[model samples]
Target: MSLIPLARLLPRRRSLGRSAAALAIAAVFTALFTAPAQAADGRISGLGGKCVDVAGASNANGTPVQLYDCNGSNAQRWSLPGDGTVRALGKCLDIVDRGTADGSLVQLWDCAGTPNQQWVVSGANDIVNPQANKCLDVRDRSTANGTRLQIWTCSGQSNQKWSAPGSGGGDPQPGGFVVSESQFNQMFPGRNSFYTYSGLTAALSAYPGFANTGSDTVKKQEAAAFLANVSHETGGLVHVVEQNTANYPHYCDWSQPYGCPAGQAAYYGRGPIQLSWNFNYKAAGDALGIDLLGNPWQVEQNAAIAWKTGLWYWNTQNGPGTMTPHNAMVNQAGFGQTIRSINGSLECDGKNPAQVQSRVTKYQQFTQILGVAPGGNLYC
Candidate 1:
């Protein structure tokens, strides 16, 4: 958590320094009974977020697997590559003695690649064996540690649920946008067509480390903060390009060597963060491998590029503040710091409390929609 800083990582900008800050601070999935190979390894958590562990860190065949605290031990680590095998400590998860009926015990054993060793993820995080048509579940529906595993009728209960690895710990849709499209609609009911949801999602590929970091709470908060600022800047995702025509020519800086190749007025406020200025366009362009200097209008025309430009600033630029907005939220520096990072020179420290409060209000409302308590430092 100490590395809390940055806006863009893996186009997700998560402060994991990689997570979804950049939740979009998002990272990690695949699907079907086993999900994706990308989702197979690490730890399979079940029953109160505990990891599936090899008992006593054993490697011998027939060792039992149980729910234990996530200790990152080799015993707790597992890989399910959708090859029909769940492996750990050089062994496969198997049913005792190849028993097929209910109450068949489960344990770690040498790889057989048989039906007894194969498992699948199905129905809302359930780990099942298609051969058994039964779920890999907790024995006796117990939440206690060291509880054994067994096959049981699928009742769609919590204990029967299993979170595959690479699921962002507990998030169901890993690497997917953290904000539901419905929630997004709710947040920006009047959003401009230029600022499409698909655009933002597409843009996430650039900052792969953005939201793929930290605990679940930090990930969501970073995502919310980023969206809120974008909302405020774009006027509820309304305007695609800056409105003031008079300010257009002023964005170009004559002193820079590159000297506004796109024309003096091309580098104007545009996109989600309302990216402006020739130097800014050059910086973000250089970072993104796009030629904003020659085509500043691309920010207004391309939705993904526009969103990417905004993310590039968020995950990188400190603006007038000391830390990037991504870092502020990841570090629990309070929403106030994000404002400082974004436009604190103009809005914080009593410069424009109204503007600051406007952003804060949107942040509060957005966090409410996301169902997370807005952490402290709500204002600058």
Candidate 2:
């Protein structure tokens, strides 16, 4: 996720080139390589310690597949039937639209035993789609959550390497109050399986401090508060990208050298936290080793990447706010400070009490549901 300009509501031009240098490089590395032990049931781990996950964990045809955290879920399980096809959820992992070009999307389709659906593990760890003679690549060599899987020429990059089942190191145990699939669904019933448990787990694994900081009670409160804010931002995860198309063109900042590779109108607010702006996308992408500046739509297209962008903001950025949201929660500065960290200038100090209260109301409800008390300072 990229940064949201605090000046987004104001007339002034806001720069999204905030320094992400302070963010831990180790966290980004861990996110890309953390994985569980190979299970008796075939499960492959790839870049960012993520399992190749079926979108929404659905067995339905045309379901998309992306990299997510290894959660020992059936959705992460796969099987090579030795017929040259990778099988999951009773379907074949296929190249979408029968596209042979670089960066074509991958999806689950009915097992027609076609050549396009067949994959081979080359000696260099490339998951080669024999039809196009291209390797299954983590789009843009990204370790960022929700980065789509595409087929590119074999590059021998870490993003293209795959550790087959029963190989590699042991799985890292998930610590703290991990959010369950049922609870996530309960919070956003309309979301169904779109916001997947494995995706959230993967993001959390990458940035453990987001929910694992401080005491268990504090951890739960932080998790609840973060989700509450995210829910409010996304309207319960119903919308993937910002609804207004008019504001899309305003995100590009031509002053930067790499200036909006995707498009002038790209980099609109997207994903759970609504990451927006060109510079923010570039910084976040650089830190996570993903090329979001070149492909900003990956946020809305991939759920894991979407959640990761949100968490990236919550944990690393202070923006126009005084403190990072992670600090506010861990230090017991109260939820009001968090609101300030996120959009204080616009919503805090009686600027927009209604919006502040809306966030607070969600936090309170989430705390109640998580069985933790919402600490004081609910107002900005």
Candidate 3:
């Protein structure tokens, strides 16, 4: 949901008769009370566009509520259930002592439906506690994780403005097939701590093919297929760089003009799909405008870039197969075609059924989690 600045929403009054004033006031009240509520799921974007999160993804009462880099975990999902309470992990967001004072710490506690836990969304996007008449404030206006949350007099400052279901967060649904941070985490719980939700969101926003190329079902399946291959490629994204160090120098293709600008050894496989080969890096860099050809380490250093590289391969390259993974999915070519597109020479032709099965299993699990049916042609 978008936030409107309070200053812009203020009413400008001109000289008017009492009857006219009363009619205007009534109209304002009607508009205020009748505004539609935004959906309850998604990120709660706050200061610095960071998300309000449950520290450590904990469900325990008293867990600190703080702003953190959005990682798309269950810890960041929030709901403003109509009972006037804001909730996460099925717990109420509460103040330390129902304190009306500024700087009172906010924490998660069992929902008691008290006035202290009740909050209302104001026109300026401040989450206001009716009892205290104060807004949920980010202490010290810090953007760092673990920064304390507090209650302060409504100021309409950026620190106090918030957008719900979070800005740039949520599931790939009917319109766009972008994966929600929650869905990504579910598919790869063991993903490297660096593979964050914000990063993946940025990656998807950067590349249109993954989510924009197909039908909603195809979009979901495409995401599943890509991540499944990514899982197999990097062992559930556990390894940031290729495990076999010997392959490092081998990735530099001397045939390319801008060959291995980061150094011959720098083009080794890195990121979710284990991007390798100097030519691949050059192409991905050209498409992403990030100069991966000159500094492939950017993939390892930046999570969003890493994911972008994976999507680049999935959408553009066919390798030994006849079609790109993007086309294979959008055209209903089956999951086996995607595996072949990614690594047909190594895993297809009955050369490695076990490896093929590994990819298929991950895809199946992901499709089930996404509540989609995995289509046919399970094997290459």
Best by TM-score: 2
Each prediction's whole-model lDDT (CA): 0.71, 0.70, 0.71
State the weakest 10-residue window (summed lDDT) of model 3.
1-10
Candidate 2's TM-score? 0.59
Model 3, residue 103: C-alpha shift (Å)? 27
Clashing pairs in 3: 43-165, 43-166
Q: What TM-score quantifies how close candidate 1 is to the native fold?
A: 0.56
Model 2, 1-380: lDDT tens per residue? 44455323322112222123322442465465644344445777787677788878898988878887777788878887666778888998899988867788898899997867877653234466645545677887666666778776544346766766521211111342345445665676554234544445544533657777778789888888898887777677666667777888988888888888899999788877778888888887776656788989877765556667887788888876778889999999988888888778788889888888889998998888777889888888
Writing each residue's lDDT as its tens digit, candidate 3 over 1-380 gives 11111111111111221244534654564454432234355677777668888898897888999999877788888876566678889898998888867788899999997877877653345576655546788999898888878887554356776776432221222143456656876787655665654445445534555756656677788888888887777777677777667657777767676667788798777887777777777777777766788878878876657877887777777777888888888899899998887777767889879988998999999888887888888789
Error of 1 at 261 (Å): 0.8
Worst 10 contiguous positions by lDDT, candidate 1: 8-17
The better-scoring model by lDDT among 1 and 2 is: 1
C-alpha root-mean-square deviation, each candidate: 15.8, 14.6, 21.4
On a 0 to 100 scale, what is the lDDT of residue 14 in model 3?
Answer: 17
Task: Estimate candidate 3's RMSD in Å.
Answer: 21.4
lDDT of 1 by residue, 221-304 (tens): 888899998877767887777766777787777888878888988877888888887778888888887778888887887666
